[model samples]
Target: MSFTIGTREILAEPRPLPSKTVRYLVPVLSLIVGLMIGAVILLASGHDPIAAYKEVANRGFLGELPMIGTLVIATPLILTGLAAVVAFRMKIWNIGAEGQLIIGAVAASGVGLALGEHLPGWIVIVLSLLAGVAGGAFWAALAALPRAYLNTDEVISTLMLNFVALSIMNYLIFSSVSFWRDAERLTFPSGRFIADTAFLPRFWGRLHIGIFIAIGAAVLLWWILRSTKWGFEIEVTGDSGRAAAYAGIGVNRKIVSVLVVSGGLAGLAGGLEIGGVMHNLDPRALSLGVGFTGIVVAAVARLSPIGVILVAILVAGLNNSGVGLQTMGIPDDIVLLLEGIFFLCVVGGEWFLRNTIRIGVAGQPVGERSVP
Candidate 1:
């Protein structure tokens, strides 16, 4: 069956492969579309979109301090964005990066606090980062196990686990007198500060070695996905599970591995935040929706590892520009609206790129097309 677009029959047939140009153009077009839409919204709200955008640029990247702040914000976002990329590349909807990140912070903090007195600063830092990775991996396993073995819906499981992870973090710092909480603080609920040595070394103005770690991770991930056999199988599996099975690939194992790796990446972000920025497991400081934002970064970058870095920085800049928008008499919500618009446009553009539109005579028979 076909619908008519005016006098011609319209068909949206899945293509075997989208054009390379279209792949690149989709993002560019989406950005332009988002800007146009945002401009309209800004005009309607009696604000100058151009001035607001310029202010955003000035605040996010035009100066040294602003650039540093943007990088600081991008540190965690890069890790989380990479996490989303890993799971999403294999068509796994692992939405628990948020929880995984929190759990990672908890594990890193617990380990750092417990071992701080006995270990050297460098040792403590290493151990804390490892703990973060392990924590995130374990948390992801909670959802991955069911998905891999029981054929459960990972989307629901992962999303639910995010709440559980948040609750766990809250319980540690806010509700219970957990080890992660500072016992000395009698009035306010606060997390214990990590050992001084555990803090990630900074290069400039709060921009720590974590940015390097994030960049290194992106590079490593890019290499694995591009040059490794495992990556090839993941690509094949993502393209078609049945085809992957036919080729003797263990689809289930890949699911668990990819998800665990994804979680580990997210967890590493938490560890970095603790060591490089926060130096403590402050729930308020950590719950900035960084994990959720990573999903958008992943999608906008079209799941490219390196692209994730660029997108994360851009997205971080957008978020950082909220203050600038307020200065321009624009509500910070305008930034949110613009972000939402960009995300929607990118998602829609992706859909459009995947399907080819055909014009045919009414009642004409169309040949069968393979579904992507």
Candidate 2:
């Protein structure tokens, strides 16, 4: 009795890559759709859509001071956006940027206090920035470790860490005798003011130096991701761990590196918030929710470094107008609702781009064939 053997090979159908034009146009279209939806909601609720939108536009972008304020608020968002873009592009989830930012600000403040009046302005500024970067990196490394070694879900770890960071910041301001505590003022919670030497120099009277730093970071990230070997490895690792491993890329090391860099950028944003703008580490002041807002900015920008800048500005403008909407007889909560809509549209766009939807003919498993 002889048996005949047969061999066959199966190949996966290649997916067509979306064109660059579509890649850019989808986000723009999504934004338009989100705005239209928001307008419809506003009109249905008995609000004048045109007037409300006009007010939002005027307050958010038409005035000089308001525009400057928007940019000021956008600085941190831009940094956090970059942070999200960096980690997300490499398939690393770093939801703890808020905590990392707080820790960085605290650490930077400590460095500023330690230097006191004697330290040169240049040295203090440099040291404070470094301290911020180091602090954020340390905080993020904690999550990175479990993720790299044990395959823990970074989303859960990062989110939980945010609460821990907030607690630490709160402790420093209220309960702890840490360097950030304000001794002279006991009524209100406030951290010690960073010395002028450590403070970031203001530009154009309205804009802080942090804006420049954010722009520089955006450019650097763009260059690194496009021109560096490390960036290539990150992209490959993100696409497929098995493929990256086969290509000689150390997956764990890449994960650690990406998270650390991402956290560092986020920390820098916090440091700038204290040193450049706020000049003090107040817990309330730090809780602008910019870190979380950044997630939206990153998603809307499709995780592109350059796109982060524009998206951050758009979000910042919306946030600025949110305050003005209340004055115009519109509920401030509506602004938050608009933001939620924008986030949904952006995420939905990404999902649509990556998937195809099909309707079932008769409600049975759409793709399944019945055995006769």
Candidate 3:
């Protein structure tokens, strides 16, 4: 017996008549589907979605100072999301944002402890902020050098680096109390408070200047990725590496530089969390995993910087609203449940955007006229 194979076999490919409207429409529909799924789960669990949503909105959005609170929570989210977007656009997976953020907090703490009260407050704050950015960038650059020069797996390098950063932070805070530990907090290991000048001034009780910083950074990054020569290089690199190299682009250099910038943004988030809001460094305080959440934001936003801002707000609001929902006999983890659904739907939607699978017998020619 002999077997015959055609040039075009059963396979998935770009749709012959792809709907442009579906590209945008599907993602939006997926979100709605995800929410509906979540609602169904809630109903099955003997809970009322309408009541829960009402409570969530009232407590999270309509409550006193809710808007500012949401913005404040979203600040780090925006920065970290932007950080992920920057590196991801270059096909660099720098998964060490959490570590970079921790190290940034450590660096900012050191600066705050040293010059918070002794030197001019304004000068000290500036130095402290710069130090935080530098520290994060330094950590990212370390992994970047290995990836760019030695072709190392960044996923492993960057992730392991996070443990290193967290360990160092814990060691400094718990082991050496002289510098980092606050004397008054004898019950627990804690760092010193930042300077008054270093503290980002608050408006309307809870909102801080970090809101503006996050927004400004988002706008600036959006502009950079949209209208600059470097932006074009990033877009090109993301689309095709071979194409980039053929175009005389320095792929390795771009990788390293983009990672550094990504790390710096993550670090800046740490600084804002430390100086603008918390005013003290503690590992527990930052255990909220803002970096990881930012990754989700970046993925959901499709790496668009402007979209990052909106997505960050939505995620932040989800978190706060989830917490609020707890008072109504609901668990906060339900929000995470919804997020999981959202992610899966987004993945499915993107898959549909690129290709459509056609059912056919195995070994049959694809896109061919079949004999009846």
Candidate 4:
């Protein structure tokens, strides 16, 4: 008996690497597609797409107060976006940012209400900001510990922690003798206003100093991620944990570090909400899912720090126009629908760009085969 041995070489056709232009262009195209889809839905719902869009655009972008209002609302979104980007970069999903943010506000408000009158303006401001960062970091570290030591699922822990944090905040507001509880305001469940010294300085009319802080944070984060050794470790950890481990990187430390930083950023956002805008720790003023919206913003920006800023502005603009849409007889639900469409389009486009499909057999050339 005789046997013949044959070797066949199989190769996958080279996929072209996407250029920077294409990377950006895809998201823009996705936005256009999402808008078109939204317009169709509007028309189907018996509303004039043109009028609805016009109203949204005019109020969101062109109107005097609306534009500024968008920026005002966008302040926290920027911070949360930064938080999401930082965690996402390290492959750590810190979904508890919302909770962390609340914790930060609670802590900062505690400090402000306690010593705000006696503290100097600059000192109060600094202390409040630091307190916010500390609060967020502490909350994030709670999740980080289990992730690092017990290898618990971070998604579950972080998400559950959000509810816990919210409950804690609510309990403090309603039950505890915290400084935020306002006895004079019987109609609303609100906290006492922090002293003027504790408030953040405004840049222009309604623009608070938080905007500058957000921008500076983004710039600093960008620098850290691109230039620092810790940044390199985070990138490597995200790319491949096994590889990072092999390279002597402390996986546990990196996880904890990223979560702490992410939480601190989110906490700062809460502090800004109280000190820069709200001026009090009100449970109702906490979040309308701004932290979650930040996840969308981070995704839309492809988790780039600079990109997150742009996406945050766009989302803020849309939210700002939501009221205008309502005034124009359009349903407020449309804004939510548009946001969902935008999120879907951006995520889908990114996924498509990163992966491709082939219809042929596995390990075989598309148009060639040998058979007996």
Query: Top model by lDDT, which number?
Result: 1
lDDT tens digits, residue span 233-307, model 3: 999998998999999999999999899999999998888888888888887888678888888789889899998
Superior candidate under TM-score, 1 versus 3: 1
Q: Single out the weakest 10-residue window by summed lDDT for candidate 1.
A: 362-371
Q: TM-score for all predictions?
A: 0.91, 0.88, 0.88, 0.90
Pick the winner on TM-score between candidates 2 and 4: 4
Per-residue lDDT of model 1, residues 273-332, tens digit only: 999888888999998888888998998888999999999998888888899889888999
What are the clash counts of all predictions, listed in order? Answer: 1, 0, 0, 1
lDDT of 2 by residue, 27-74 (tens): 778878898999999999989888888888887888787788888989
- What are the runs in model 2 whose C-alpha is more than 4 Å off? 1-15, 355-372
Model 1 pairs in collision: 200-275
Candidate 1 local distance difference test against the native: 0.90
In terms of TM-score, the best-performing candidate is: 1
> In model 4, what is the error at residue 97, expressed in angstroms?
0.8
Each candidate's lDDT (Cα)?
Answer: 0.90, 0.84, 0.83, 0.85
For model 4, residues 1-372, the per-residue Cα lDDT tens digits are 112224433333334576888777888898888989998999899999989888888887786677788888888999999999999998899888898899999888888888799978888888988999999999999999999989999988988998998889887777776667887766666788999877899866788888789989999999999999999899999999999999999999999999999999999999889898888887887857887888878878888999888888888888889888998889888898898998999888875465433445444555632221
How are the candidates ranked when ordered by lDDT, highest leading? 1, 4, 2, 3
Clashing pairs in 4: 180-191
RMSD to the native, candidate 3? Answer: 4.9
Candidate 2, residue 368: lDDT: 39
